[model samples]
Target: MKKVLSMMMVLLLFVGMLAGCTSNTAPTETKEPEALKMGLVVSTLNNPFFVTLKDGAEAKAKEIGAELIVLDSQNDPAKELANVEDLVTKKVAAILINPTDSDAVGSAIKLANEAKIPVITLDRGANAGEVVTHIASDNVAGGKMAGKFIVDKLGGSGKAVELEGIAGTSAARDRGQGFNEAVNGTGIEVVAKQTADFDRTKGLSVMENILQAQPEINAVFAHNDEMALGALKAIEASGREIMVVGFDATDDAVKAVEEGKLAATVAQQPDKIGSLGVEMADKVLKGESVDSFVPVDLKLVTK
Candidate 1:
């Protein structure tokens, strides 16, 4: 009977030992918070317009010691896609993109979403996609502002040639839309409208062609400063009685306005847009809600 009691105690102790071993082997699941890694895919760093944006984003990212990876798209949708793909491979926590084309960028945005990375669009936006936030100016309003400036400069009646920016860009489309609405039913007629690809050389060539076709062109509405400058060259070469209007209030364009060469420009604060975009991204990453459309203020520069 004593031996039986000993065996029972031994079995109980073994069971207890097994239970302790099992308890020790069980893992305590712990989840670690991820570090913030940010990426920016810009249209082009070649232009001073996007350069200011880059500077603003970089400064803000460095302020908080967050990792920032910036890539230049050169206004190519294919390149933009490749850049975003590379960033995804790196497993960035968030992405900031200024899409080259609204529709073309949807797939890239979807890929990022599939990877569980939040994307914030800056300056320009994607068409219909899952984006955390879109920060930009009221481009339509800006276009209207430019149109009003043209009318005021011409005293409400003149023949104008619209030097459009690159195709498939929000800036080009909305600005053109607003300008058309402002001039709707007005005596000031748009004699010709053509794309200048937002480049000075292209603007010059396209303006020259338009001038040949419409020699009585009274004004040229260039979508950006570079194109405006190009249009100025064509006007000088053609010896046409013409005034030039431009957008994006770039330094050179502002100087032109100050010099009485170009009439006016709608100033867009790209730097401010970049800074604000970063702030919004940060807020969203912290599990906070942000505004869907963050509109940056635009100013008209005539002097």
Candidate 2:
């Protein structure tokens, strides 16, 4: 009877050891991921095109398990510089910027460079700085496309008016250069060239004044969709049929083309520019080498 009791006690001890082992070997709960942060500074959120670009960057950040902090410059170069300084203060791992003015943004970019933060430019480029990459559509090529479209629509000869963007921006300069190059010997006379600052109200007002002066204008090319839509408003009010072409195919501009309101627009992939900027920032943060000039695709959109 004693021997039987001893064997039962040993069995109970074995059961206790097994229970302790199981408790120690249980699975652990998963921990949450670390939040990595990046910065994006855009020229303006007032335009739908830039809004779409911001949305694309946010989506890409979420996909890559990172957080994006965005700042709007409101199309002010001084404000853009302030925004970059603020981003540097936040100690962001990287920065992506769309400059309001290419040359004026140099100081802001210089600040980022001094901070050792990787910089990537989207849509517009800085005239001076050491940026890791510049991701944008070939604005020069897109401009040539717009010019060619206008020339073709006008049968290679017509009086045209050019509504320009902010004077010192790369977008404005490159687009103007391309357009001028394409129409040099095509018999398309640029009757008037004026800077509307890429604003709808300014574009409308400027075009209205131009219409009063040049009633024989047959084609209008604005540097951006906002200006194009504004020019359309003026053209409609004048009760004249003018072939209007623009750059940056925003959603409204594309719809306008489909409805035959505006003749055509050179479509730059703004969303792709934003997303690729983020991707390149990630690469730079990871010490990966990326192409200096990452060209996004451009296409001519016509009704």
Which portions of model 2 show Cα errors greater than 4 Å?
A: 1-33
Q: What range of 10 consecutive residues in model 1 has the weakest lDDT sum?
A: 31-40
**Per-prediction backbone clash count:** 0, 0
**lDDT of every model, 2 decimals:** 0.87, 0.93
Give the alpha carbon lDDT tens digit for every residue of 1-303 in model 2: 999999999999999999999999999899997678899999999999899899999989999988999999999889999999999999999999999999999999999999998899998888898899999989999889999988888899999999999999999999999999889899899999999988889999999999999979999999999999999999999999998998999998999999999899999878888899888998888889999999989999987
Q: State residue 17's C-alpha deviation in candidate 2, in Å.
A: 13
* Candidate 1 global CA lDDT score: 0.87
lDDT per residue as tens, model 1, 183-245: 887879999999988888999999888887885877778888889999998888877668888
Models 1 onward score TM values of: 0.87, 0.90
